[model samples]
Target: MAERPKNDHPIRSPDIALPFCFFCMMNEPDPVLRTLKITEYFKEMPTRDDRESVLALSGLWSIAMTRPNNPEFPEIGIFECMAKLICRGISDREWLLRDQNVYIPYYAAHIIGSYVMNRAEFAEIAVESGVIPPLMELLKGKISWVEQRVAVRALGHLASHEKTFESVAEIGGGVVELAMEISSIFVENVYRQFFCLKQRLKYQRNLLTRGLGGVEIENRKAEEWAIQTQCWSLHLLNCFARKERHLNLLCKRDFLKNLCQIWGGLMIPEAPGGIGLLKTLCKTEPGRKMVADLEQVLKSLCVLARSSDERQVMAIECLLSLIKDPETRHRVLEISVLSLVDLVELENGSELKKPKLGNTLTQALLQDYHKIKYGNQKLHSERAKRALEEIWELKVEKKRREKLMSEKEMKKRKLLVGILKKQGNHKFRNGEIEKAAMKYTEALNICIPKMRKQRLVLYSNRAQCFLLLRNPESAISDTTRALCLSKQGSPHSRSLWRRSQAYDMMGLAKESLMDCLLFACCRIKLKHNIPCYAARMISKQANATSVFGCVKVRTFEETKSLLENRQWGNMTIGGC
Candidate 1:
């Protein structure tokens, strides 16, 4: 056969998706359109080359769409399946994953990590399938180190999951080793942004109530979780430690010292972090008594130059995340502060109204500062200056509202959002339709812009809110909008399922069942959920009207029996 002419635009650019993007999945309530688009992607993309990338990116769009504000989980399941098929095909093809051709697997890993970060259903699938182990197999051989880095990254993601943590541990997983080998290539500072935000938000509430500022008990539950998560992470460091043995050369000692100190700080809280020798002394106190006894160990930071100390960076970060908690930080400062210059000094200055007692780190700072000034040990002079600048900046901001908003206002926002959500949920719980609508609308008035998802959900709740509020037209419009942007807006059984409910609300029975079959089959495929579909249609098919409207399907005994046999929750399905 003659060679086919190659179009100049061989690989499709990322912009191809901009034209037909269905982020309308957020507000899309149409079951047929959603499913058809997905089918079109799989069926109509001209080349095998572009199809997978397009499919993978489409999956990325759904990540935010499926969050709690919108519970269209089934759409996520659908796109994840699509993403997997594309990635699986790439993994199966060896030539496709090589050097000049590495973008394939690189993008694959990017997709895997994106989904992994989102904690998509695919995460559970990735763990159960030992796919992480097999993907780690790519770490060897002559493929691009960048591709290898991606494989290691996926492992890092798996390593983060609590369920997969021990399972990976049982095998001395290769992910750590691979990551250690290539730590130089990856930057992880922003990866923990969301986790950090949630922690700060929790503490911000505490500051409001006590009229006390600063993260109290920062070492407790919040920091504890970060610490406990580290055993697996620290062990992954063995991967880096085993290679390029001189981590000390490139990476800073304070950096590595901070790493060990985080875990060590957790073990012995009477120490300061960011600079705590006493905490290190006590935690490593088997035969060592004085701080000098562990100088060799403290020197581990200098040795991290080879494997590129990311594990160390992450470990220390896990600890720093908790320093906002007072009890944990207090204990940490007492035992481990290397000098009198604790982070508090950098944060609050020496002359705050009432100064804190923990300052051993101040002393250590003096000593280390002297040693580096005198050239006793190797140092990243520029990094040290930057660290000092940070300290000076902290001193200025210590007593200031770190998060800016006043305690009362922050509390009001948090309180109002949480309470409003609960009230609306409660109204629905009690089957008080009118009350729920009022509650959600009231909440809507108080909501702010950054809380866009909540706004989206508030609008959704309002649709249901309106239904109970007895405003069907507004209800239909709100729900229709919510479904469009929701994850289920994609072609999947779930969008169909939600649409079924919406059409039923609008009194459009036939239109409701049109995709009802698709949704029903989807549920049945999952085994036990089969009854939901049948229940939706139970005894309702007898109507002769082809028109779409909420036609009450007669079900006196049919529903009564459904109530009796399915271990009924005493919940009545009214006007079926």
Candidate 2:
């Protein structure tokens, strides 16, 4: 196998400051010896002497994160030490280590994940150090979702390497099965237990607050982490699915049905969620057959394909993949035709800009559909022509009518549009929001597209009404249109604010946060709490993107009792 590519820039762990300062106090100046001393101190330290072990683990975690490519740390048995601490934390319930022991498994697993992330050789050494079994124990929920987060991360790194993948696969189909379950149903419980609950653990408070904020910040951080846990599990599942291992386990009908619903939210745009795994499955025969058999899955993809969500491209790709295979093409063709047709003209559509892939894929799909449905006939099928006409007729007729209008009649239409706007504003003040929205729609219909400034006002006004009606999706679309018609960089601030609010109502924190920031930037001076609110969301996002940010806060007592009472019995790895 070729060598794993390196990360040119490694992520510096945010928790490194205090640990690095502590390491600076050491008399030994050699970095390798310093690392070895730390590892040996952690490995040989007796249980219950908690402070030094915590310090040691922190130092090692920093080293692993900041300098993972250095082989000296792994050669000194750091991975083995991490495995030992993890196992002891799981099986041994020492009273002295109780308060601090809850943190050990998380740090140990994080250290292993960080070190093995970019280097296959390091991953191989990690597998050799017996990290997988202990990591599997954590993956099986020996403690809590926090430990499971890092454990899955570590296993994902191990599974990515050609040499180390077999070691992880050797753990059995249970790993894939558990990953599928986490990807599907574990986020709600994780969110409720750590984030929504009023009682906060000390570690949880430390991670969320970090001496800077309050309950709101903590809640946002918890929500981001909850979503991230699912994202990381999907990453692990993708590793196996990418190579077609455990297809029998990964391609479950219920899992695929649920996977279509997991979009990973707009918060972490990098994570494709369930559609990502489905795309991988569609690459193989059994996987494609399974996905093609689920009409509900196809319907979900059709809905997502028509959405403005970032994952729309992934949805389209899955549909295109389904259509590529002759065997599966017929099964998906009828369901996919209308959705694909909506995209074919987007490249040349009235919108200022759109995804180029949509036009290319849809045109290809339409041609293929025509050939399949009409068999080499040059004549368009009635259904195909009707679909195309439905898409283009109104826009074409509008242009043609405007071109034929006399100057006298055009001036009358503009006058009527202005009168309609005033009436809409009057209705809005009189508490007739629906009537106000209807007035704006009528004004917009009469308002020509060339009258962009007029159309902008109409769209923005309608967006406010949609917001009041609790239809955020429509509000987002209207504000988007208004923003497009406004100035390029500094669009209308009201439209930005409305769109931000709409995104927030849709549970899209990052999108809302971005629009909020942009809205502030558009104005010279801010008069509202948007800046403060944006700052809070920024803090939450910072925590969300941190290397080990998703680790749940398990109290020492809870961790100890849970680990002690946990029993393997005859269970296989990841069977829990």
Candidate 3:
């Protein structure tokens, strides 16, 4: 099991438990104990062993120095103390010292001040000693006001260092996710910290690195300084990311996910690196490994392609560059052909997401199709249309396969229902839920009396379709039939849980509660199982009335509270 990051320390040794080290309990009035009286404990370090003891002493002293305004130990950077530990013939506990929060003050100092004193060596040492990850964590952390100011200041200086660039480049593609998530937090506030961190970063380093990009700057200039500083910050960010994954890790196909998330402000407009760098990263081996799915990457790339702005043009240029490769270009042509047909059938302006590059890509391919089908090869290509089958395969058909496979003994005679199930599934995953329901109903209509298991699955599938279409009565009736036909150990138990969810969704709480209890008691014996737990937790009811007009029981916040405390099974009379 992974160790939690909680600040609990190991048991202490008896020797170090004396007056000096155990300063909180000391009464001998020694000088070391006198200084340590401030901090409550030395974080319980084990120093009985000779080697670990020296490290423990170092860690204790380091922890004591955490507070900057303590007015005892002067502000010395961690690199200085690092040299002290190495030179003191002290045991190897550099990691222990780095792990302590006391060095946070020193870490913040290094980020801001290292460049000021031409301290490239110090920066290199930290980078080599595996300190960059934690430092980057500090940069993106929910730090105190002073800590934030210090961290940004330090990162600004370090950004200009050649060593900084090399280390960041080598931070590996594996760290892409953590980097993206943490860096994304600063997209808004970074504008505020940019200037302070930038000029305060390394001027000499920037001087050497800032090559001819047809952009010139007078560092000492006062007007619109924020703009200049932001450019530099974006540059440093892009420079770091240019090597890692792309402009931001957000654009990586495997890196990001299509989970439930708020749509707005997801784009980092301040960093124009997304379409440009990543369009290249996708073709590279490192970039390829970083992405789990190439097709998914292409779809994500489509989001950027939808941009009408100048960078979108650049992004198109990048895409066009990729198309020059026969395989990649062939893939784009195929995917876009089907995607175009999918879009035109829908209402105009259905897409609000700007990064919907797929739309423009469709247009581009349709025009190309006109050029080829009429002017060149006359290719009314079914293969291109077949690419939609993959999208349908991955996203849409998941439900159908899941539903059909739920049975232990499904009848071979009812195989046509599986086909319609796939059609219904594709329709639903493609955001055509009503059509999907129609498909499911047609499938259910075809299920023979001989195929009871198939009928149960079709009814259950249709109930889901009803819920998705917001038709509560039809959904409830279908689910009722499904529950009755489904055997105790049949695959229909899943249908039981889904019925409860559908009932919960329809605000028919009496029906919801009945199925919820049935699932909780019969199907899932455990409280924390996903379906039962979520049915009871996520579904809401009126403050004072259930669907049957009885007293409303648990609220959303109460459920959330139980979830936070891991006390979900604590449901009881009057305490819900």
What is candidate 2's TM-score against the reference?
0.65
TM-scores vs. true structure, each candidate: 0.33, 0.65, 0.31
Question: Model 1: per-residue lDDT, tens digit, 1-576?
Answer: 222222112133234443233344434578777666655543432234432343344344345335422334333343344345434534555434322222344444544654554464556665654456444554441233334444554555555565655554555534444433333212221112112222232211221222233444432333333332232233334323323232432134333433433322232221222222222322332212222233433333212111111232222322332223333433322322221222222222224653332132333333344444466643444545444443334333332443565667756875798798888889788988778778887876665433545655776776765655556546544544343333321323443445455556666554455546655666676674666555646336314221111123324454344334532113121100
**Which 10 consecutive positions of candidate 2 have the poorest summed lDDT?**
3-12
Best-to-worst ranking by lDDT: 2, 3, 1
lDDT of each: 0.40, 0.70, 0.42
**For this target, which candidate reaches the highest lDDT against the unseen true structure?**
2
Better of 1 and 3 by TM-score: 1
In candidate 2, what are the lDDT values of residues 355-456, reduced to their tens digit? 555455644465453454455633234564455444343345566888898899889999999999999999999999999999999998887646778988
What lDDT does model 1 reach? Answer: 0.40
Q: How do all the candidates rank in terms of TM-score, highest first?
A: 2, 1, 3
> Which residue pairs collide, candidate 2?
146-552
Model 3: CA > 4 A from native: 1-162, 169-177, 181-241, 244-252, 256-270, 273-277, 283-304, 307-311, 337-576
Report the lDDT of model 3 for residue 509: 50
Ten contiguous residues with the weakest lDDT in model 3: 258-267
- What tens-digit string does per-residue lDDT give for candidate 3 at 516-535? 55555554555445554645
